[model samples]
Each structure stands twice: as structure tokens, then as C-alpha cells.
Target: MTMKKKKTIFTAVVLAVLLAACVAVDLTLPSYHIAVTVIKKATVYALVAVSMNLLNGFTGLFSLGQAGFMLLGAYAYGVLTIPVAKRASVYQYFDGGAIQFSLPEIFAGFLGDTVGSTVGMLLALLVGGLLAALMAYLIGLPVLRLKSDYLAIATLGFAEILRAFFQWNALGPITNGSNLLKSYPTFAHATPYVILAGLMIAVILLLITSTYGRAFRAIRDDEVAAEAMGINLARHKRMAFIISSFFAGIGGGMMAMYMGTIAAAPFKSTLTYEILLIVVIGGIGSITGSVLASFLYIFSSEWLLRGLDSGKFLGINSPIFKNGFRMVVLSVIIMCIVLFFRKGIMGDKELPDLLDRRSRKRKKEAAGK
Candidate 1:
């Protein structure tokens, strides 16, 4: 068969498979809601993982500011979309509260009045992305110049500083310092997590397939080599870092909105480490690995570890283990994955390459026969 015909057939087959999978996934099961919630949580970690992969996996950068970006995005979206009256209720010190967008303020047409909450949520997500992107651009400037461990420390410190800044009395008008915020909007249906998961998956696919993504990989493989070949290292590195931060921020924003409260303490070093563990366990540079790892980590924490320690069986109740048990098991799992599989599950390989190799091998065997 001609190459064009073969290509067309392959494209059709893939499209059919994807459509079938979507349909299958859409059909509800007994744990439909639970699965959706898990998927959403997985998506947040996956987005941050992909962003980190673009830097550390593909670009050879080792930064750890995902938590910071997430916080920034979360707060930005939280503050922006809030209704002015509700702001004071949600965060007491503000007094001024939040500004509400009129139908015309949010939309452009006659149907704006009837645009619905879904449309408004989408807009809020977009705003989150933009704000995160802007924050990333600003942060990327000074930090991107550093290399390796220094960069990682710098980024980690940046996150902590941001957390501290939020807690400062000067910023109390918005964040309300140590006080908890309430009465904010929530993504009640499938959970903010489901929306976040879907978005991160779409974004990971977009970045890895795009020309910009290729550039990111090239820079990761060898910065000097990439620069010598006219790759514009600084510009591309900055771009990749900013994009990662932007999505991370969006994830954070979604998390904040869903939780209906934001506190500086919970989002500090511990949050950063948990996400880092998710990324490392998932494989540093592999989007698929990150995604799989997130699910594994979250689910295992919720179910497997609990089962193991609690000794819960077919009909017997066992004493539950302390909360720290899950973290200990998770850490061991991460270490094992790192030690046994250094390159991660996907490593530097794209899924398509494996398929291509399989097809070529089959073709060769057939020709010999």
C-alpha cells in the first residue's frame, strides 16, 4: 500500500479508538463520582508534573516552585472573580469585598444573561491561566538564569516567600492573613478536580506535540547545543518555565476555589514536597508517568495503604493506621521506582515511537515470510 493510504488508515483507526474510549469512559459505573474526583486530583498533579517535565525532564532544569505558582494562580482567580459583597464575608478584613461582573461584563452578546454558571467557570479558569502565565513570566526572569540545584532552591524559596507574603499583614485586605476565607464559589458538579484533570490532560497533549514543546525538549537535552543551533536558549527556557508556572498556577487556583478556603500554612513546604513526590514517583520528565503516579499516589494513600495497615479484610475490622503511614509507604514506593527504573516508565520516549517501532518490526517479519 502507498504511504498516504497507510497513513490515512492509521489516522482513522486512532480516531475510532479514541472516540470509543471516550464513550466507554462516559458510561457510568458504580464508582463514577469517586473516579471522577480522583481523576481531577490526578490532573492537578499531572499538570504540575508535565510543567516540571518540560523543564527538568526535557530541558535539564531542576526547579521546585510548582507549589508557589499554584498558590499565585489560586489567589489571583479567587480574588478576581469574587463578588464584592461576598469578599468581606469570605475574608473578613477586606471590608471592600469583591466586584461582581454584570452579564455584559462577562459576556459579549444577548445571551450573556443566560450564559450559565458553566460559562462563568470557564471564564474564571481562563483568567486563572492568564494570571498564572503573567506571574510565571515575572518570576522566570531572575530565577531562570541559575542552573541546577541553585535554581531548585531559588524556586522553592520563591514559593515560601510568596506564602509569607500572603500571610503578611499588609496583604490582609485580600488574603486576610492567618484567618480562613469562606463563601467563595465552588465547582460542585464533578468537583474542581475533574475539571482540573481534563484540562491538564489536554494541556500536556498540546505542549508535548507542539513546536514549542519540541524546542523545550531540545533545550533540555543540551542547552549549549540547542543555543549553538540557534534555538535561542534563554528565550525558550523562559518560555517553558513560564508555561509550566502558568498551568501550575491554574491548578492551584482550581484547588483553592474547590476547597472554598485558602490558608498560607497548609500550602507551604509540605504541599511542595507532596507534589514533588508525585512528580518524582511519576517519573521526572514523563507526562504519562506523572499522570499514572498521581493516580497511584492518591489512590494508594486513600485505599491500598489504608487496607494494608488497618488489616481490613473480607469481614473483619482492623485498627486503622495513623495518617503518616501512607506517606511512609509512598516514600518507599517512590524510592523503589527511582532505584529500579531510573529513566521512569516513559522516560525520554514518546508513546508514538513505541508504536512506530512495533509496526516496523511487524512489517520486517512479514516481508521475510
Candidate 2:
């Protein structure tokens, strides 16, 4: 077989094995297991970070509105998917709530509980994405015209404005008005999250390899030159913005499912900053890097450096190793990376490209020998 075919087969086998392992672990292990939660959170963030990368890394759009789009998705999914029977309890604060119905429950009535509910959840996720995309399209029209820091500030302001709007009491009927939206459907295992995130990333990879993706890259490199080359900057930029927001919305839906509760407070500028930082550290334009960095960030923050918060690490009792110290260490590490390795781990290169380079190198060395 050709080396290309061998690589394809190898990649497929690896992915299959990984998926099976995730399923086994999710089924066999306890729900509260650290590995399970970390993986789930990482998976969600990976999707969001990739979406951010699509805008900032590939399209040269300095958007900081991911948190806003995510909030919209979380609220949309949570509001639509809450069990009908439980709505009264969940919305007790807002005059017994505004929305009295549930989409998934309706689906269950017609399609049977098992299949219908799953399908309904998927549809709700799609609705959430569409809502986010719609918002992006509307917002992009005006905001996409801005350049660099101006665009970033505009998007950041929009996110804050969105957060405030969600918290407004007048909109309480739809958003629960700063109150927690709970009792929504949740994923029982990491398997579903893994599958969904992988699918989304695969779709993004396909988009990045398309003609439009090349246009986006050209814009990122030189907007003036790309325009001279007959590329429509406004159209492509808006397309990337809408597409990124769509995935961000889906990621937010997955996050809501993972958390089993939703609140507007968590989806803030800070969340956007975190995801953007992940993209920067992951090699801004590389999907594989974003994913790998997501796992690493989660593991380091949630697992490895957890002991630092409690002042116990390698049995060393240092006074400085108290609460918030973990973040300090993490921040320093990120700073070091930014200063020394600005291009990040993958440096805008995909994993397949790196593998191909290595294979070529090996062949040359073998021939020389």
C-alpha cells in the first residue's frame, strides 16, 4: 500500500481505538471521576477554542464575542430542553416562568422516550447554533468592518451588553433573569461529548481545507493583497464569523449539558479571554494544536496544579503555595510561552503536515544510509 493509504488507515484505527476507550471508561468509571469531568470540559473548550481560532487565526478577525454567542446557546438550549414537569420548579422565581413547554418532551411524546428525546436534544442544539449564527450575521454587518483592536473592543462590549441583557428582569420570562436554569438534560458519559466535539472539529478541518479557507488565510496574511486578488473581504469575513459563532453555540450547548445547569454569570468576558488564550497557546491557526492544548490546559489547571491551591505539593509546605497560587504559576508559564514561543506549540501548522514532514525526513535519511 502507498504511504498515504497507510497513514489514513493508521489515523482511522487510532481514532477508533480512542473512541472505544472513551466509551469503556465512561461506562465503567464513576460519574464524579476527575478524568471524566476534565475530559468533558476539555472537549467542550476544544470546540470553542477552535471556533475562536477560525475567526482570529484564519480570518484575521479579532473577535472577543465567543462568550456572548455561547451564552445565547446555553440559554436557548436550557430553556427549550428543560423537562415540562420540572419547569414549574425551575422557574419558580419568575412568576412560575414564561415558557411552559419543553421541546425534547414534545419529541418524546411522538418518537418515544429514548429516540425522540435524543433527537430533540440534537434539534435543540441546532436551534441554539442557528440563533447564535443569526446573531453573528446581524452583529457582523456592522462590527466586521472594524479592524484589529477596534473590532476586539466592539465584540467585547457586545458580550458584556449581552450578559447585562440576559440579566435584565424584563427578559426574565425567557432567560429566567439572572436565575439559574437547571434540571435540563445532561450527558451521562464522556462518549457523547467526545463524539460531538470530534465531529465538529472534523467539519471545521474540512472547511479549512476548502477554497473559502484559502481566501480566509489570504486575508489573514494580507487583506490588501487578497482584495487586490479579487477576494471579497467583507463576505468571507462575515461567513467566518457566522460559522465560528455556530460552533461556539454548539459548544455552549454541550457545556450546558455537561454542567446540567445554566447561568449567564459564567459566560462572561473572562470566558472569552480564556478561550482566546487557549487558541494563542495552541498555535493560533492549527486545529490539532487547539485540541491538544485544551486537554493540557484542563489537566494542568484542574488536575496537576490542584494541590497548589491547598498548599500541598510534593509534600512541600510552602506558605506561598496557597489559594490562587495555581493560577499565578499557570499565568507565569503562559507568559513564558508567549514571550519565547509566540507562535505556540504547533506554530500554525496542522498535525498531518508535521507528520508528512517527518515521514519525508525519515525516507531521505534512509536513502542516504
Candidate 3:
């Protein structure tokens, strides 16, 4: 087979195996298992991290407003998906909320409970993405004009402002006024989360290979040169910002589904920092890197090392292994990884690229013989 054919087959096989494994685990384990939670959380992070990487790595836009967009999305999904009957309890502080009709209910009436609710959930996510994109457009008009650290600062400030605005009592009827948004429908299985995140990431991969992705890369490399070559610098930057925010918004919806509850307090600047850290560790410009790094990071922090937090880890039980110990160990490991691979684990290369390199090396060795 040709190298391209081989790569395609390999990727397909890997995906199939992963799907089967996930399904098996989901069927065999309890819903509250750490593995299930890790998978769900990792997929959510993978989508958001890739979205951030699109602007920061692929397009060289250093905006730090991911959490704000996510907050917008989470609220959008929560506000739109709460069942009509449950609104009274979920929104007791706000007189059953400003919007009473749930998207799921509207669709379920005609499409049946199963498929209709699924469709409704997807629609709500799309709405959240659109809302975030709109906000990005308005915010980008002024903030995008800033450069480097100024741009980062402006975006971070925007996130903080957005978080506070959501908590404001004046908007309680819509946002629940600092209360948790819960009782919304959520996926009981990890498969759906994996499928959704995979589809979204695949779309991003396709975008990266298209002409627009090239334009993004050019701008990242040198704005003056790209602009001189007929690329619309301002327009592309705005597009990148808007598109990234759109995906971030959708990712936020996924996050809400995973958490089963969401509050504005969790969508803080620290959340953005964590996503950014994932992008950096995954290799900013590589989609596969982001995805792999996300899973690895989540597994380490959420599952593999969780025992340290309870004062016991691996066969060793020490006083030092008490609350927050896992984070300390995780931090040291992250530092080691960073020091070892200055450019990140994948360093801008995809899985196929790595395979090709290995193949070429083997050929060279045979040729020398």
C-alpha cells in the first residue's frame, strides 16, 4: 500500500479500537468511575484547548478571554436546556427565569424524547457558540487592535468583567444571579462526549489544512509580509478570534454537560490558564498534540494521581501526601516535561508525521547496508 493509504488505515484502526474500548468500559464500569469522568473531562478540555490553539498557536493571536466565552456558552446551554417543569426549582431566585421554554422540550414534543432531546442539546450548543462568536466580534472590534501583552490584558479583563456581569443580581432572571444551574439533561455515557469532541476537533483539523489555515499561519509568521501579499490582516485576525470563541463556547457547553452543573465562579481566569497550559504542553500548533496532551493531563490530575490527595499514593503513605499533594507532584512532572521538551511533546508534528519519520529512518538504515 502507498504511504498515504497506510496512514489512513492506521488512523481508522486506532479510532475503532479506542471507540470499542470506551464502549466496553462504559458498559462494565459504574457511571461515577474515575475513568469515565477523566474521559469526559479530557474530551471537553481537548476541544477548548484546540480552539485556543487555533488563535494563539495557528494564528498567533494571544488573547486570554477563553473563560469568558466558555462562561457565556455554559450559561447559554444551561438557560436554554432546563426543562420547563423544573424551571421553578432551578430558577426559584428569579421567578422561574426569563426564558421558560427549554429547547429540548420544544424539540421533544415533535421528535420524541430520545432523538429530539439529542437534537435539542446540539442546537443549544450551537446557540451558545453563536452567542460567544457575537460577543467575540464586539469585543474584538476594540481589543483586537491591541498587540501582544496589551491584547492579552484586554481579553483577560473582558473575561473578569463577563464573569462579574453573569453574577450580577440585575441579570438574575436570565443567569440565575450567582446560583448554580442544574437539573438540565446530561449524557450518561462517555461515548457521546467523545464523539462530539472528536467531530469538532476534526472540523478544526480540516480548517487548519484549508487556505484560511494557511492565511492564519502566514499572519502568525509575519503580519507585514502577509498583509503585503494581499492577506487582510484585520479581517483574518477578527475571523480567528470569532471562530476560536465560537468553539470555546461549544466546548463550554460540553463542559457543563460533563459537570452536570455549572456556576460562573468556575469559569475564572484560572480556567483559561489551565487550557493554555494544555495547548503549550501539547505543542501549540498541533491539533493531535493538543488532544493527546489533554487526555494525558486529565488522567494524571484527575485519576492516576488522585490518591495523593487522600494521604496515600502507590504503596507509600506519608504525612506529606495529604491534601493538595497530587497537584504538587503534577506540577513537578509538568516542569520536567517542559524542561525536557522545550517546544512541547509533539512539537508541531502530527501522528502521521511521526510515523513517516520512523519509516524514513528505517529505509535509510537499510539503504546504508
The candidate scoring highest on lDDT is: 3
Query: Which is the better candidate, 1 or 2, if ranked by lDDT?
Result: 2
Of candidate 2, the 10-residue stretch with the lowest lDDT total is: 348-357
Clashing pairs in 3: none
Pairs in steric clash, model 1: 40-193, 58-220, 59-220, 74-253, 83-98, 84-98, 84-99
- Against the hidden true structure, what lDDT does model 3 obtain? 0.93
Over 217-330, each residue of candidate 1 has an lDDT whose tens digit, in order, gives 778778788788889888988888877777777778777765677676667767777777676776666676777677788777765566555555345565555446566766
lDDT of 3 by residue, 1-369 (tens): 999999888888888898899899899999899889999999999999999999999999999999999999999999999999999999998889889799998999999999999999999999999999999999999999999999999999999999999999999999999899999999988999999999998899899999999999999999999999999999999999999999999999999999999899999999999899898899979988899999999999998898899878888888888889898887787787677876787989887777788899999999999
Q: TM-score per candidate, in order? A: 0.81, 0.96, 0.98
Give the TM-score (vs. native) of candidate 2: 0.96
Instruction: Say which candidate scores most in TM-score.
Output: 3
How many steric clashes between backbone atoms does each model show? 7, 0, 0
Q: Model 3 off-target regions past 4 Å?
A: none
Candidate 3 lDDT for residue 217: 99
lDDT of 2 by residue, 1-369 (tens): 886787777678777998898888898899889989988999999999999999999998999999999998899999999988888888887775888888889899999998888988998898999999999999999999999999999999988998999999999888888899999887778888999999999999899999999999999999999999999999999999999999999999998998888999899899999898888899989998899899899889999998899989988988889999998999898888888999998988776566687888999999999
